[model samples]
Target: MKYTVKGTQEEGVQACAKHFIGNEQETQRSNVIYPDGTEVAAISSNIDDRTLHELYLPPFADAVKAGVATVMCGYNRLNQTYTCQNSKLLNGILKEELGFLGYVVSDFYATHDGVPAIEAGLDMNMPGPWDSMTAAMTYLGGNNASLWGQNLTTSVGNGSLSEERLDDMIRRIMTPYFHLGQNEGFPSVDPSGYFITAVTAGYIQTSRGAPPARDVRGDHAKLIRRIGAEATVLLKNVNSTLPLKTPLSIGVFGNDAGLPADGMYVLGDDPPYPGVPRSGYEMGTLSVGGGSGSGRSTYVVSPLNALMARAKNFGGRVQYILDNALIAKGDFSTLYPTPEVCLVFLKTWCGEGTDRASFENDWNSTLVVERVASHCPNTVVVTHSAGVNTMPWAENENVTAILAAHYPGQESGNSIVDVLFGDINPSGRLPYTIPRREADYALPITNMTGDQSRNASAWQSDFTEGLYIDYRHFDAMNITPLYDFGYGLSYTTFEIVGTPSADLLQKELPPFPPSSQVEPGGIPGSGMKCSKSRLSSVTQDQSPAQLLCSST
Candidate 1:
């Protein structure tokens, strides 16, 4: 967060911390009133105050302390009230408690009521006007699509909202704009290049002009390649099967190894209607995920492309089967003579607006890996995924190695080859626990059925797990995971020689934060303070608490 805000602001851009609080799931995120008169309320994240402060509020608090320029309230309700209009969250926690001077903006079409949201502390409604479908719904009295704009002005005029609150909103919205010196020489926005097209039902086209063709990728490709290589996580290696020595022949399989068959590297080329599943691998390499959070790259380098280039340079033979079905059928022996090594590339697509059905790999990738490993003794599995994926074949004798290459972006192929052929050592670690079975999680993705179904008057998602989530839940339940969090492998090894110790200098510590006046950035001297203490101790246990002060 510090790097993101400082780096972007240094380059004349503002970074925004988003999904304010308790937006855990995406099911029924937004309010909807169907043409058939059926209504689905936004899901409510019912969080206890202690759990909210301890678990969900730290990252956002850190982001505020880092002087982030903007904060976006999420679509879901926080404690049964829409986040944009939740007073305890936006006004109490964010604005007053954390001393966040930046304005609060709503997610796209997330605001429900103008007066309540403004009074609660929402400074801005994203993309003010409603789209055609929303406007039609509003006209039919099914929904109140536009929360601000003319309605906001009328609310203030009719005494439903106060002018003082409106002015405060304006002040908060402009504080960061001037503080960041955006008025001096901010770059002009090229709407044609960045604006969304209006061909879709829920989107309003901001500009009618054709988007200008531009290639703004300066030296980012080089940086991307280096990061990609460093981020590749080597999950398993048997008998040093990796670091390929320019084998005489290599066999590549899986649709993920190449571009999409339809040649659509980027999404949004086709209309985006709700419930219509976007083409995954059939569109190309899974460099990014799907939905609003997905990114766009000028080009994506698939693993097959990088392997073929390496093979050509080394005068080696390369054969590939990009069809998932053909590989899973286990009948490719005639087309593929046994090669020195076989590389199977797999991926799972996940993003905002939806949750994956399971942790299993998509496109029948588990079957593909089993079939390939059965035939090829020296099989190397490379997986690209957004999150945890169950590996049923990790213990197979034929599966010599496995690399968890999570979404390498445009340099996917080169980065994997770099780690595979010893050009780069894999150093990335898993961010979440990968359990042996889905049941091991204990805390399953909540299915709001019964009275809490989508058609119910209100959708409630109780945070029953509390602070015990992910690895913490595993530890509390004493369940062994398939691969623990932060689990990763490297070609080389290192060891610490000396014991670690810490000292506590301050005899007394304040239980609450300083009550300093709120400033543009934050409370003065509110940042954590640490120092060497007179009382010192050393322990062989080497827990992280032993190395740092409690204040830190």
Candidate 2:
């Protein structure tokens, strides 16, 4: 928390820790169809106090402690209350208990009632062009202004809100800018004069008049390639099939061979400006997913292209096949007799506003893998996704290896080929647990189809697996995961022969510094009651393999 907040602040950018609370699932934020034929306000996460303190709220609390500049409330509900208007969340927990001096902002179009939102402690509403459907309730007088403008007047006139409170809101929002010298008299309006004056006053002095501009592309590319290679988690490998030898005849199958560049939306079929051809758009691979927060790159080097380039130098050849047609027809063969080795590229799309349709690799992709493995004993599967996907083909005898290259930015292709050809070692670890079945997740996620079928005001989600999020639930329930947290494989193996010990302290860690602790009960004078903290901690011994990986 300290690193994320302070580090970004030091970089001259205010780090806003976002989607403040209870924003785990993005299934339906606007409206939803319940089983019965009615539409509703969408599903909400109902988190008990124990769950909130132990699992959901700690990171946010830490962010506040670290002096994050801003906090953006999510587009969901905390318990039955909409988070943007939940006074307990905004005023009570965040401002009071956490001592968050930073202002609170609403998610895009997340603000509903203006007066209530302000009273609840929201300092700003973001990204104009409000939702047309809610315009009536959210519009103030002027052409694109939010309802807050008019609501504040009405509220103050009616004594529902005080002028002092409004001033407090303005003060909170302006405080950080003032501290950063960004207030009314700052010379953003005249930066040239400001720079000249600073230089004249010796505040902007430098040893050299100007520095030489270095070509950093090669350096940046090298760093990106290294990051990508280290992030390529080898999930499975059998019979020493990886780190392919030279003189390799590789048959590459699947459209994923050309992995897209980063910054693509996590939803949607194509880029927004679709009328223009791919050639006219920024030069790069297609997006991995779609939605807000997606990225776009100027250029992308696909795995197929990278591998082909690498193969040229090694006296090796790569046979390319677009498995789209084959998969559609359920003809999962390579057509050509499988070469000495087959590399299958697979990808699944998932992101904001939708859940994955299936968890099993046992689907069509599995069929393609099964067939390819059957023909060529050496078949390696490379999967790129926005999240962890279950691999039912893990036990497939013919499948030689599996690599999880989850969203490997622009240099992914180069990274994958390097690992395959032994140019770089594979050492990435899994970031999350992959349960064998969708049901195995800590909490049950509502399916999009099911929600779409029903017309309801809102779907109520209960976080029954309180304090047992992700691997915690698996540990508590003794459920075996397909891939445990931190699980990953590497091209090389090592054995550890020593154990380091630490001295045991009889003292109980000094009750934690006050800054790191949250006092029980509600905020001092809000009259709002809150539960005592039910937070717990779990520590697991690092397996020998993990210790070795860390040392490496």
**Candidate 2 per-residue lDDT over residues 1-552, each given as its tens digit:** 667888877655678888878887776765533466565665688888777875677788888888788999988777877888899999998999899998998877788787778889888877443553334223333365656766667889999988898888888887777765565454334334344323322344642543333233665778888777777888887876877887468788776775443333222423222343222122233334444544444457788898889889977788866554564454534455557888888776544555555665312667777767776778899887767777877778878899888767677789888888767777677768888777787465754455443645437777776666666667767889989777786655543333322332544533522122223232121111111222233336321111111112
* Over 4 Å off, model 1: 131-145, 194-196, 199-209, 265-279, 448-455, 500-552
User: Which prediction has the highest lDDT against the true structure?
Assistant: 1
Candidate 1 has an lDDT of 0.75
Worst 10 residues of 1 by lDDT: 524-533
The collision pairs in model 1 are 260-283, 260-284, 505-533
Q: CA shift at 68, candidate 2, in angstroms?
A: 2.2
What's the TM-score of every candidate structure?
Answer: 0.85, 0.74
lDDT of 2 at 43: 65
RMSD (CA, angstroms), candidate 2: 12.4
